[model samples]
Target: MRIRPTSARGGLPPAAASAESPAALSGPDGRRLPASPRRRRPDLAALAVLLILGGTAATITLMLNGSARVSAIRITRQVTAGQPLSRAGMEEVRIAGTGIDYLPWSQHASYAQRLALVTLLPGTLLTTQMTATASEGITPGKARVGLALKPGQSPAELRAGQRVQIISLPRQDPGDRTTTVLAQSALVDAVSDPGTHGPPRLVNVIVDAALSPRIAAYASNGQIVLAYLPAAH
Candidate 1:
């Protein structure tokens, strides 16, 4: 039998022995494989936790940002529908909470002060533009009537659109002690200036169709005096 070098075993050379050592086996191209595939480090767990917590905090903050409240606005004057509103005439107002306040004013509200101005009350008229919507409740009408005064009669002698009690004496014949007082209401249609014949001051009055005849008869006599009625309650 031929004798090989003493260091050789099973036909492997000395160089192969050094390559089989643990350090060399752990190196690249080693048949024993490198560092057990380098276990994925567990240190990344804390970073994942931080990211999750941050996302949760952001979500909570976004949920708490909205609210509501009641508001008030002022009526500048006796506003009739179809009339324009002037800034000089109107003012801002505020209202107390009834129960909830939807769309509460921001920190930058224009009328933060002047809390004395409360909600609008009845008889407080608002301009058409001040109204929430364009639609209106008042209706317009025609059939214009005017008041005419005789010479030397003062305009004050005519009361526009008033209710009065009239006492007519029967033809002076004095029959049946016939003293009849007619009581009715009439609107002041119009009145003429004492000196002018061209046209009279116009007044608008609303009355029932039946009452129109009686009013026309009495008014034509030229002896009638007009009176104004107090506004209805």
Candidate 2:
């Protein structure tokens, strides 16, 4: 008798069995329909591409933000009206460009002789219009005058950067007791700290240049008073 090799488990191979009855989708008409395509699996190559794109977008955004900033000048200390700017009182800071007429750090030296048009607090961003370059006064139309006011001349709670009205009290020379308004809208630049039996309170105010000469003369008589004018600035 001749020996012959049979298939494993005495059954048809996988290929021949599958070919006998192929897998297919059945339609409503009892006909075969096409099988759907196999779904694809995610791979590291696609993930790597996504990560690269994200990093590029972040880098571009950082560059655009950095390029939009510019260097400007900042005051390091309090500078009163009519006070000149100094090299040690200024520093450079970076800010987003706003297209305003702000003072640039490179031109800080040019503002040394110029006076502050208004009382500048610390950490202030300097601007071109805040300085008077033409004269020793605070501004083209304003002059800063220091008045030694008596205790009752100004409010005890008066502070700097406040608006006030300058009035002159009548004297005994004539029978006139009328009060005079020297300045309607004056800016208080600086206020001296009070103390016990100390010197008179020295208040610095910026008023019109035309009234400066007369105000300084009248203030020496100790008859001038500072009337608080809120919301006048």
Candidate 3:
């Protein structure tokens, strides 16, 4: 007997036979699979440009907000009614969203020589409503008078623009022991601090011109006392 080699079914080697068959790369439905698509890398330059634009927009928005603020005037120290406005008593501050009602630092000169219309506390925002001219202090038929009051004669909490009554206490004479009211509804114009040597405080009051004589006599004789009145509404 003679030995012979067996031939493949398609007359090709097994490896080459599998390679040429369509079923090797086909799906279960016998459709040929498509080639995989290539992935694309990100554009770094475009991304950097977008980031810079976003940051610039944010910065512009912040700058716009900051520019909306204005420099306004504020009181640095306590100011009494009738006291003259001075630069030392005021300071400039940056305020936002204040509208147009406040006094700005640029307009300080217009109000510097003016007087305060009421008691202004520290840190108060200066406004046109809080100031007035010196001529406003002396109204028609009113005269300002000064009185030197001892410690117990005047109210400890006395301030400018306060309403008070000028009272005349009884004298040392045994024949007359009557207390009289010299003037009523007197407006306090100004008050000075007590002296270091224990002297009496000086208070200036605006009263009716007709009552000036009586108030002067009583004040000079040290028989006058100040009675605090309720604030006018």
Candidate 4:
């Protein structure tokens, strides 16, 4: 019998079969594709843009969740030391909430930092207005004076008749290096807040006539720091 070619015999030859398969039809670069299959090219720019937008949204969300802003508060009526900052005493004078605008500037510390400086306890009622009035005499004594207490100060620790000491710290004098006693432990006799009615009562105390004049002079020139102390025996 004569040997016949496979294609002639209704079967493709080995070479013909190999050519029809996908591997044989591919290009030298390997990227070449047959008509039956295709590869898609991704848009790099579009993917990058999406990533940036997502990051921005996440940052904004974090800032919003971490910080909050509050409106400036005022004495709607009056407040006292040893008193709480009650809702009735203050109203959110302005509509404000925490956000980017509310954030403190870089020059100043955060709102939390300033808040730490607050010595007043919560719920402290404003006892008296700090004043710079003339002293009655010379010896150390307590006088009813005025104070401009900042908003959100606590006066709760204060009692009506509690004894308190007032002392002024010494500061550096540009002229001399010596530190002089600004004020020593002075006594506060009483405290009173009239509320919306009238002026709060000034702190009063008994002191020598000589010290009275000095107290008056100090109030006139420097700030008066009030301190609460234990009751006398």
Instruction: Go through the candidates in order and give each one's C-alpha lDDT.
Output: 0.40, 0.79, 0.81, 0.41
lDDT of 4 at 74: 36
| Model 4 clash number | 40
lDDT of 3 by residue, 9-110 (tens): 646666666777875656664674666998775797789899999999999999988998988999877777656677777888998855768898999877
Rank order (by TM-score, best first) = 2, 3, 1, 4
Per residue, candidate 4 scores C-alpha lDDT tens digits across 98-193 of 332422222121111111111233332222221111232223333354332221221444533333455443434666444333334333334455
- Show where candidate 3 strays beyond 4 Å: 1-9, 12-35, 38-60, 139-233
Residue-level lDDT tens digits of model 1 in 8-61:
356566676666766655544655434666678567988899899999998876
Cα RMSD, each candidate = 12.7, 12.3, 9.8, 17.8
Per-residue lDDT value at 186 in model 3: 79
Q: Model 4 segments beyond 4 Å from truth?
A: 1-156, 169-187, 194-201
Task: Please list the residue runs of candidate 2 whose C-alpha ends up more than 4 Å from where it truly belongs after superposition.
Answer: 1-137
TM-score of every model?
0.32, 0.46, 0.45, 0.26
> Pick by lDDT: which candidate is best?
3
Clash totals, every prediction: 15, 0, 0, 40
